[model samples]
Target chain A: MLPTPKKVTVVAGSGEGDHKLTAFDNALLAAGIGNLNLIKVSSILPPECELVERLDIPPGSLTPTAYGSLVSDVKGDRIAAAVAVGFSDRDYGTIMEYSGHCSREEAERAVRAMVEEAFRRRGMALRDVRVAATEMVVGDRPGAVVAAAVLWY
Target chain B: MLPTPKKVTVVAGSGEGDHKLTAFDNALLAAGIGNLNLIKVSSILPPECELVERLDIPPGSLTPTAYGSLVSDVKGDRIAAAVAVGFSDRDYGTIMEYSGHCSREEAERAVRAMVEEAFRRRGMALRDVRVAATEMVVGDRPGAVVAAAVLWY
Candidate 1:
């Protein structure tokens, strides 16, 4: 552990660009994590971590993040992404990420249930779960939707 | 959860398709998890679970899985995805996922380090870490690569 992440921020964004990869980068920029080196990691909310609405990360930092994203070049197609984190007062937390051809609410609901079910599997009680999401409808240009859980020290 | 996930399997695959969405499905099919409903969940390898190379899953079942995937439309562009799970003798395990325009081995090494870093953050000693990955270069069609950690009851 370089430094145990003491805080985590959930972010979601949608963007349009000339190409698929550029659309993804634009989405990341909209989510406020575009500049950092995103080290895609799995879902775990460390103990006693604080949840924030926004994150201010250093550029070029190795950020451990869990994310779901979709990019589409087809017109009129919907792309959605969602992330949820379930936490208990006395236990570590669970995280979930989902993305596909769906609405933001549907994606959010699915991931939330996943987090709750994960806690249930662990035989732990969850106080609450928080969700973040993004959606986009592809048009003439490539579009992307992204949902992410960013871990920070 | 309905029943606690007692077993986990890691899988990786790559595929090509006419479109980005189809490329993703083809990748999943190559990974042997295409028919099932992938319920995306966070990275907690439950205590007392067994790790296996291949999974015997019933079709249409809701499987809790954590994955990283990338799709590219550029010809000759390389894409890679990797997943790593860190386990200890007396503790729950942690999982990490990574995907990008890189080689498979590089992706695997980055994810493995992320898993070890996660365990270290928790002040836990890791007995070992297991890794799985896939990579491919796009040709005329869109290409996708995925790596996953699937949890089963």
Candidate 2:
């Protein structure tokens, strides 16, 4: 019999040393992001250098929700700093020119606004997020993970 | 836009308190057959039990892999475990019996044999596994996670 798939949530731009979050923390393994600030400062690692290779192929992926003015409404509470993972600038451009309903520019602007607001709400800065890795989940279903991870933090 | 789903691998099983596994060691979460002795104990949880209930639901489910099996083909030192996970038992059963051109019992038997071989190859026994909880996922395309998790460990 086929076993069902395991669910994955990718948190965007979560630092490389997320404390209290080691795999042993909750018997949970993580993708690229980490934040180990709570450890003795000496134990802390740079976000960019600390990236861990994923155990296997990146699973399925989802286009991240555009961060926008509404970001304050959605992630103002829990997020510190984040980046867009799936959606790209080209897609944003196409959406902006021909599609009046919503455009690529709109999407980009929304993401920018959300990223800023999320950071501001947490008293953080863009530079604080040193690296952004595009999580490519290649398989039958790919997009949900992008959403879950961003939403988690 | 929809967000992507991330794939993860977590082994869940119920824990047996005995410092050493005895033949009588029984797991609260295990549902299948196993000898009582030749036991090695670990603290683990069984797969989620609500998998069946959740599998039948439509929108989203927390049920982990509803169907799981591992078929083996071992010739001498070449041992392999063919793993599969499905949305539910019915979904897997039909494929095994009809599309796969194998009897239902045979498909199941193949999986069991392969799984046993896998344990043997790892120098582990079936009785050593202590399942904890089944992690579940629900989405439009949930196949990759299923495959990744099943083949991972």
Candidate 3:
């Protein structure tokens, strides 16, 4: 079995590039997690995982992450991404992500609601919710927004 | 850095369900990997990784995987998914995935081409290629197909 991550961090950023994938890469660079190979995981925070202020993973390391991202090529298009982590008092936490052509506040609200619903479905009491969100308007080039919960050792 | 996975397995399956997410879930179940938490990784097989006959993951374990999946709700729609792993003689291998409204043969070809292109770009010798593919025609309920290369300890 893979080891559960010991630390997690929330981050959000926006960037622009010539193409969608490059725009996403720039967004991740702006978010401070561009160097690692991200393994996208579904929204489950391991039991006893600790929240950290920042991530310090080595370059090219495999990092498990839960993320929401949106890229738009149309000029003036509004795009937003958000991620939320809901803590439980006595068990594992839940993570949720949202992305759309909307405002940052709307994206954040959607992710928070998703986290709440997830916790409710598990019959777990929500202790706290940590959220990160970003929004941007596309220009001539493609623009991307990314919000993520990075889980690491 | 997170530890590199030592073993990998390829599998494919198709299933039907009431909703898209559940259809995807059912597809995973049919693939014999429904209970594990999948962490989606990009196209890279760790150096010296061994190919295994089957996965033996415990329920709820975090499993790193590279996969392609497609869900269709339109009746008579043909959906397909495929994953390919291209091994190199002296370095890490590359994985590629594709999903679309197509036949299983087309999907497999597409994924194999992607793997070859990835290896060429890296200037790596293509030692071997392993592929898994599946296709399904949607009925009344939503249908999903999944192909995955699961990486484990």
Candidate 4:
């Protein structure tokens, strides 16, 4: 039996040009969470609800206050929230990437922060997260939505 | 609101694609198939399962065969074997054509035919399906694990 288990959540992000969506899915699954097991996480996000802003945004133009406001707009409708995710892959880091519009330095920092938070919340450690994947894709022509997902064990 | 209620189902020739997966999810919601849902369908064809030489291939290679196989697999796993599949569109057609492989006509015919046998035992009519969108994608790769979800109201 394996010592570690991976978890993943599938977020349908915009992929107008680049294979960003699939890439993201791949990243999460590679991180060991591509199981996509519905029984593990069915409808994590509510159906037909406006998404709120990130509770924490990477160092970027996305203002925390603005992000908080966006959250308020979506907080009312957020229905499908899940505490954990499922995976098909034995590892889940294949699909992770840096956050969007942020420098690599900032992206790495963001990941570190997230890892810490995940550990604090779940009592897990960075070493335990064997596979890891992250991304930060920006829209070339505009009118794109910035969304992301996290997978860990 | 519109007068006619909608019935939709998105069929993924391969289960793990981004657009097709997204469209399939949207179709299920459009069909108003209660809250029934599924995630990452496990391929019934085992790792050692070999492709047999068949003089008679279904209209769509990804036809109800794999999907039907998937249904039976799900049923075998304790879900209901009695399922209904309603076809709305073939979003992957363009990709198939662009790959310089299957012509648009051949691609469309394939998905349409597949939708038929998928629901054969359900006592349902393929024509009764409400197709919302069907587009062909060109210049693509091959070998996709197909998947479909049926919602019964």
- Model 4, C-alpha of B147: deviation from truth (Å): 15
Q: How should the candidates be ordered by TM-score, best one leading?
A: 3, 1, 4, 2
Please list all clashing residue pairs in model 3, or write none if there are none: none
Q: Write the per-residue lDDT of candidate 1 for residues A47-135, one digit (tens) a residue.
A: 77788877887799877787899999999999999998777888567667889999999999878866765566457799988888999
Better of 1 and 3 by TM-score: 3
Q: What would the DockQ be for model 4? A: 0.03
* Tens-digit lDDT string for candidate 1 (B1-153): 246788889999998765564576578879987655465777889898799877886543446788999999999999999999888889799989999999999999999989988998999999988888999999998889989999886
* Candidate 3 docking classification: incorrect
Report the C-alpha lDDT of model 4 over B1-153, residue by residue, as the tens digit. Answer: 001111123333322123544433343333332134332221111111222222232221222121221111121121111112233132111000011133334434443443353334224343333212222231122122222332111
- The prediction achieving the highest DockQ against the true structure is 3
lDDT winner between 1 and 2, please give it.
1
Identify the superior model by DockQ, candidate 2 or candidate 4. Answer: 2
- Which 10 consecutive residues of model 4 chain B have the lowest summed lDDT? B91-100
Q: What residue runs in model 3 are displaced by over 4 Å at the alpha carbon?
A: A1-3, A16-26, A29-43, A53-62, A86-94, A109-129, A140-142, B1-4, B13-54, B58-62, B71-76, B82-98, B103-144
TM-score of each: 0.54, 0.21, 0.64, 0.27
The lDDT values for all models are 0.83, 0.22, 0.87, 0.25
Clashing pairs in 1: A121-B1
lDDT of 3 by residue, B1-153 (tens): 557899989999998865564576578878887656688888599999999978897554688889999988999999999999998999899999999999999999999899899999989899999999999999999899999999999
The regions of model 2 sitting more than 4 angstroms off are: A1-50, A53-153, B1-59, B66-99, B128-153
True contacts kept of 1: 0.00
In model 3 chain B, where is the ten-residue run with the lowest total lDDT?
B17-26
- The predictions' CA RMSDs to the true structure, in order, are 13.4, 20.0, 5.7, 19.3
Give per-residue CA lDDT, model 3, range A1-153, as digits (tens).
578787889999999998899999999999999898988886577777899997889999978898989999999999999999888898778777889999999999888876776566456799999999999999999999999999888
Rank candidates, DockQ, best first. 3, 2, 1, 4
